[model samples]
Target: MDWHTLGSTPFLPPLYWRAALKRKITGSTLPEQGLRCRVRINPNDVAAYRKVCGFADSPILPATYPHILAFGLQMQLLTAKDFPFPLLGLVHLSNRIRIHRPLGGVSELTIGVQACNLQPHSKGATFDLLTTAEDSLGLLWEAESRMLCRGVKLEGEALDNPLPTPTQVSELTRWKAPADIGRRYARVSGDYNPIHLSALTAKLFGFPQAIAHGLWNKAHTLAALGEHLPAANIELHVEFNKPVRLPSEVTLYCSAPGSSGELLLKGTGDLQHMVGKWQPIA
Candidate 1:
């Protein structure tokens, strides 16, 4: 889908604006309901996704990136002519994913997506979307993603505090990820978007080399938290500050005080920022 031209119109028509205002007061659920899509994981597709995401050649897929397929299905629903809302007006605010188990090889899975709650803000509007993916056995692989869309704004929010300030910088553990890591991750995750791996591919996107998947960094942060705290149920929030280049060492440092914990996962290279937050699972 050519996302570039999806919502070229700068202003919503007067009628559409009035409808949106009514939706803000009454709060409308996403128009698409009971929408479902399914796909069988293919080895070749997996290989491509792994290569793009920068994963090592292992039997199991990296815990993250399954959303690539899941979201693809959701996109189909969103872009349908009958679908509600204009795609271009949507802006990504935040996202969180939890992996129940490692996806090994190929398998069939089904994804269900629905829109919920249309919130109007001073800037424009916000829509809450939920997506769920599960295997044939009815076991949920992952659940719940919250996305925020900013309607129209003169200027986007500024980053006054771009740098993270951890109260305590603790000892860090380093991990050596292989160069072929991207290929392996892409294979399992089905996210062969081509920006994550290959220096040539990455150069087009202005990267020195293929960088590690954001989800992989998330997993590293979760692992670091597991080392210092119990992993029964932890709320993790990771902000993608910068990319971690391929074949590089990533150091994980964590600090926890009471129920709150802060984690800093940094790539030892030019792009030195990777930050995450952890709160005790409630």
Candidate 2:
């Protein structure tokens, strides 16, 4: 994973400029290299990280931090002599994850990541990458993340594009999310973002209530996938279409494969509100 060589492409063109404009509006970008890493999900670590993230108690690990292990491994990969790229300039444009299981205590986990296609943009270049994580028993807990990167521009105002209408994929699951889900997630993962806590905070952000953190949904989704899919060496891709409201009855709609195979998980609501997609990492 020579990030430097990977990102050394020169010359910006009109198409890239157009793509950059579109990304500015959509908040999308590509990351450098994606690779796997390992982490020990210790209960103590979860409790410590939770307090640091500002939760009153240890919430469940936010669904997203497992990918952080991927990122941590990525950093190590970048340090290899064969590795390329400067770490300072990269920025996280967007992130999406689907959890297949709930992380209860400390366990050894493996993460998989890969750099994807790069599209040019006015700011610089937009690169995409994928990441996945699994446990020792060969159970996949979660998968999928997309990231973007670009060079700084002089004008500072990158071009923006109109919002594309979201396509309705499928209805979300009908499982009832626990009332303490948000607090639990906040505690486990050290993310104290008020939007996942107080009603007033969510109201300020235009949410109906203090919605469940995205990572919580990811964790639960991973737990579910692990039940049916072959845990070892699995890959997945997911998109966040809509927010899951607190204490809501959500039904998970998943497309999974047989043991030693591939699968897709697309979720929707009873009212047919499309949530997102979960497929093997390409």
Candidate 3:
């Protein structure tokens, strides 16, 4: 397949100030040029991501690191010319990541992201963004991220994407996420979306207070899984049910493995703010 260097997303008035207008996202346009970029792995940043996610550094890149690296390009594609939905009101419904193999520190990568498959949800329209990263060898990693554009419900609205409910589950440890967690994570992952910065800045985006980055929560959950990971051929998935406002304590839990297992990052209440799982990608 042909690939090109990633470029700045085509800008329009809608993306510049999505928050200012409180506009309901309408339309369903897809990008003509999918997001593609060549990225050399930054050893320092990889180490930083590991540290933030509470992992001991190694030459092997964490499974979630590629997704972290590809996030910007994904956003650009979502906001590209004539994008159907506004960026501000969209909710990340879930993510499925497959780690085919480990990429060492010295690997040079080609990353591609494309928005695909918009479907209907009771509350809105949901779409999938597929992101993939590879080197000369073959496919290194890939992810399917589903996002919800609230208020743009298509015909035959489907069930809301809820957190996973597994029959056999266990409660893991709890951690108090500091108010500055978002910025702290941004330093590691380079995802500085303003809604995560602080209360005042987040207010501009309609969040009462700053919220934790969904990807950060995924990495944290994976880190907590520790040695439980399958020896090889791992695929991890997570659903973001609700936002975890900053300065909060949340619990982590997981379900018994039948096919894919479930991991829950829960606030004080029973609500699993985020749900995730991992299995061998057969």
Candidate 4:
């Protein structure tokens, strides 16, 4: 596969429009080309991300922070001319991140991203945007983000991996998701999906009001479990079940750190927003 080294991070807004206007390709295979960039981590940006995601101050990068570094490249891959799906209407179904070690005092990272694993879902087609972060030493972090394209059916049998069903559980803690969180996260993560921006834009896409980003909840969960996280070799998998509307109260249910367990985030009326788990990679 060919690797295209980006000189700088591609701006997201224009790519969305460009992908919307491009003619959709009709095939299963993604482009063989991939994207890579060398980024010097900005201390200010990292601090901003931690504050938004409720993480405590730390010299090491948060487990989910690499995704923010590679998001623009993922957007570029998804919006390429040969990509089979449109960029605007796709849904983030799930995310799986693996951290090999905590990165601190690392001035730069070589980030890479590519699209793969095209599969048929009952609702539509789904695919994975695989991303990696590395430095001169070796790979530090990697992730698989599954995305769904509604109304686009493929020929293969749809895979069935249902999200965990909501059950009554005691809340570990509650968090207030402010109305501007979507915009705040967007500023840090470069994901400006309209559904999460404002009630006005969200209503156009069938939501009553702006919703929080799925990964934001994932980040928050990790932040809450910060004490339990190991210094290296861990896996975090999260599935998006329902959208948490802006200006809403949400709760988290999870087993204490240093053990195996489920992590659930629910909004009002026991509406499940996310279900997930984390384990050490021994």
Best-fitting candidate, measured by lDDT?
4
Clashes of 1: 16
Query: Ranking under lDDT, best-scoring first?
Result: 4, 3, 1, 2
Candidate 2 differs from the real structure by a C-alpha RMSD in angstroms, to one decimal, of 11.4
What is the number of backbone collisions in each predicted candidate, taken in the order shown?
16, 42, 1, 0
Where does the lowest 10-residue lDDT sum fall in candidate 4?
Answer: 162-171
Sequence-dependent TM-score of model 2: 0.47
Q: Relative to the true structure, how large is the alpha-carbon lDDT of every model?
A: 0.54, 0.47, 0.75, 0.85
Model 3 clash tally, residue pairs: 1
Q: Which has the greatest TM-score?
A: 4
**Cand. 4 TM to true fold:** 0.93
Clashing pairs in 3: 29-84
Off by over 4 Å in 2: 1-40, 43-65, 68-144, 147-173, 256-282
- Per-residue CA lDDT of model 1 for 1-282, tens digit only, reads 112222111222432333333322222345635456666666676566555544455565544545665655555445554455554334344345544444554376666666665555554655555666677556445534434444433234423233364658685677766676666665554334355668788777567788776665665555444446432244455666666678787777778544467767676653545665655544
My TM-score estimates for the predictions, one after another, are 0.55, 0.47, 0.86, 0.93
- For candidate 3, write residues 1-282 as lDDT tens digits: 234576542233444444344355547655555667777776777877887777666666777888877866766666554577767667877888888776564467888988878787777778888899888887888889898887875777486646546646698678777898899898886666779989998998788999998888887877777666763478888888778899898888886544467677889767668866777897
Per-residue lDDT over 90-137 for candidate 4, one digit per residue giving the tens place of the 0 to 100 score:
889999988887777777999999888888898888888899999888
**Per-residue lDDT of 18-128 in model 2, one digit per residue for the tens?**
322332232333344555545566667655544333323423454445654554444444233332333333434434444455554536676665655455557565444
True-structure lDDT of candidate 3? 0.75
